[model samples]
Target chain A: MTNPGIRDDDVLKAAEQWRREGRGVAIATVVQTWGSAPRPVGSHLVIDDKQNFLGSVSGGCIEGEVIVNAGEVIESGKPRLLEFGVADETAWRAGLSCGGNIRIYVQRVD
Target chain B: MRLDLLADLNAERAARRGAVVVTDLADGSQRMLRENEAASDALLKSLNVRLRGSKSGVHEHGGKKFFVELHRPPLRIVVTGAVHVSQAMAPMAKLLGYDIVIIDPRDAFATPARFPDVQLIVGWPDNALPSLALDPWTAFAAITHDPKIDNPALKLALDAGCFYVGALGSKKTHARRVEALKQMGVSEAKIASIHAPIGLDIGALSPPEIALAILAEITLYLRKGEEASA
Candidate 1:
C-alpha cells in the first residue's frame, strides 16, 4: 500500500478529538484502488459536519464527493461504499486526474 | 468505526505499537486486534503477513470480505555498541527512514560527541530496551565485541522477534557466544537466527564499509524477509 500523506497520525486523532468536541464526524478511507490511484489503500480523509477535512484519500480528487457522501452516512448512521473512476460521469465532476479508480468506505464515528 | 475503537487505535499508535481494525465489508462490523493478539489466531494467516505493517486493504477470507486496516509505527533500528560502525550507521540508517538508536552502558563510548545525530542511550540494554518496546519494525545489531555488553542485549533482541538481529564477531567468537547464549536460556533456534559474522559479505574492511554492509543487510531483510509477501 502506498502512503503519500504525512498525516497518518493526525487524521485519526483529529477525528477522535472532533468527536469529543461533540461535532458530527465521518471517516472516509480508501479501501481499494486499481491502477495509478492517487492514494494507497487505507489512506484516510476525515470529514466533519462543517465540511472541514484533514488528510486525503485520493490526494485532491474525489474527496469532495467522499465528503458529501460522508454527510449522508453521518445522518443515516449507515456506512456507504463509493467507487470513483475517470470513467464515471458523475465522478467526472471531481474525477481522478490520474485516470485511476478508487473504492472508498465512509462511516459515521459513533 | 466506533469512537471507543478509534480511541484505542489512536492509543496504540501514540504508544508506537501496532494495531489493526478488521472490518467485515458485508455488514460494516469491526473489531480491533493488537499485534500479539493477531499471532495466535491461526486463521489469520493472511493477516499475519501484515503484523506491525502499515497497510489497509480488503481481503477475502473464508469466502467473505474483510478490510484489514493497520496502524504501525515507523521502522526503527536499535544498535547496542556505540562503536565506530554505529557512528557511521546512524546517519546512513536515518537517510533510509529508520528511527535509529544506539545503546551502550559505557559512558566512555556512547557519548554525544561520538553519536551526535542518533538516539544514544548511555545505559545497559537491560535497563533501556524494556522502555523501547522492541517490535518487529525494529532491526537490532550488537557489535560491542564484548560479551558482557553484547550478550545480554542479544538475548533480549532474540526474544523480541526483531526483524533483523545481527552481531559482529569472528567464527571462533560466535561459536563461544552461541554457547553463552544457550546457557543464558536463548533457544537454539533463536540463537541460530543471529546473523553472526553480520552483514552482507562484500568483504567490508573499514567501519563505514561495515556500516554500509550492515545497512544493506537490514534493507534486504526489511524488504525481502517477512514483509516480502506483503
Candidate 2:
C-alpha cells in the first residue's frame, strides 16, 4: 500500500468504477523490460468499456496505444499483447523516446 | 459520478480472477476504437455499424458481459511506535498513499508537530489496540525496540490478520524478542510472521535508508501476493 511517488488513487478507483457498469475492462501489465523505459516491470494501466483510463504502464507513450486498442478488447472479450521499442520511429511518435523495449499484456476482465 | 456501481464491478471481476479498465467517450462521436485481435476487430466493426445505424454514442458494452469495475480501497498503515524512526517514516508513508496512524504512550514523542497528518494516540498497546480498528488488509509495523510496546502490537497485528507486519532490531535482538514473546504465551507459529531485523539486507546505515528498506520490503510482500493471485 505504501509506494513512493504514486498518488491520485482516484484514477485507479475511477477505472474500477467503469468496470462495474458492465463495460468490458482490460488490464495492461508491463511484464518484460529492457533498456531505459520510463516505467518498470509490474506497472499497471487499466481501460474500461467507456475508454476511461487508470494507472500508467508507460510514462505516457504506450498509454494512448493501449487505450485505443483496449476499446476493441471491450468488444471481443479477448486479451492482447502489445510491444513498443526504441528502434521504431512510429513508437517515437507515440512518445516513447527513451529507446528501450517494453512488453504489455492486455487481458480482458469483468 | 457513478462510484458505487463501479466498485461493485471491480469486486465482481476480482472475484472472477479478472481485472478492470475504463474509457471515456464524449458526445457527437462514434468513439469506436480498434482492437488488437482479429475477432475483436470484426466485433468492433459490427458494433460501430450498429451504433452508427442507431445514432447513439453512449451505451454499455455487450449487455454487461464484462465486469469493468472501478473501486480502489484506501491504502492504510499502522506504525506501532512514535519514536524518531516513525517520525521520519510518517511523511514518506503519506507520500506513498497510506493512511498512517501512530501508537505510542510517550506524549513527548507522540505529538502533533512530530506527525502533523498522522493519527497519533497517546496510549499503550492494550489501550490502543481496541480503538485502532485494524483489518486483514491493513499493514502493520512494530518499530519500537521495547518488548512492552512491540509485543502487544505484534499480538494485535497477528490477531487482526494484517497483510504485513515488521519489526526493527538486529537478528539476535529479534531472536531474543521472540523468545521473550514465547515466554509471554504468544504462539510459536504467530511469532514467525514478524519480519524481525526488519527491512531488506540492503546495507542500510541511516534511519532514512532503514525506512526505505522497510518500505521496499512491504512493497515486495504486497506485489508478490498480487502476482501469486494474478
For every model in order, the fraction of real contacts preserved is 0.71, 0.22
Residue-wise C-alpha lDDT for candidate 2, range A1-110, written one tens digit per residue: 23455533444455665566666777676655779977765467878877777778877877898898888876775666677887877677787888788877666655
Question: Model 1 — TM-score against the truth?
Answer: 0.79
| Collision pairs in model 1 | none
Per-residue lDDT for B73-159 in model 1, tens only? 678899999999999999888777688999999899989998886788999889999999987778999999999989999999989
Residue A2 in model 2: shift from native, Å? 7.3
lDDT of 2 by residue, B94-174 (tens): 887677889999888889988887899888988887776776557889887887898888888888877788889888888
Model number 2 iRMSD: 12.3
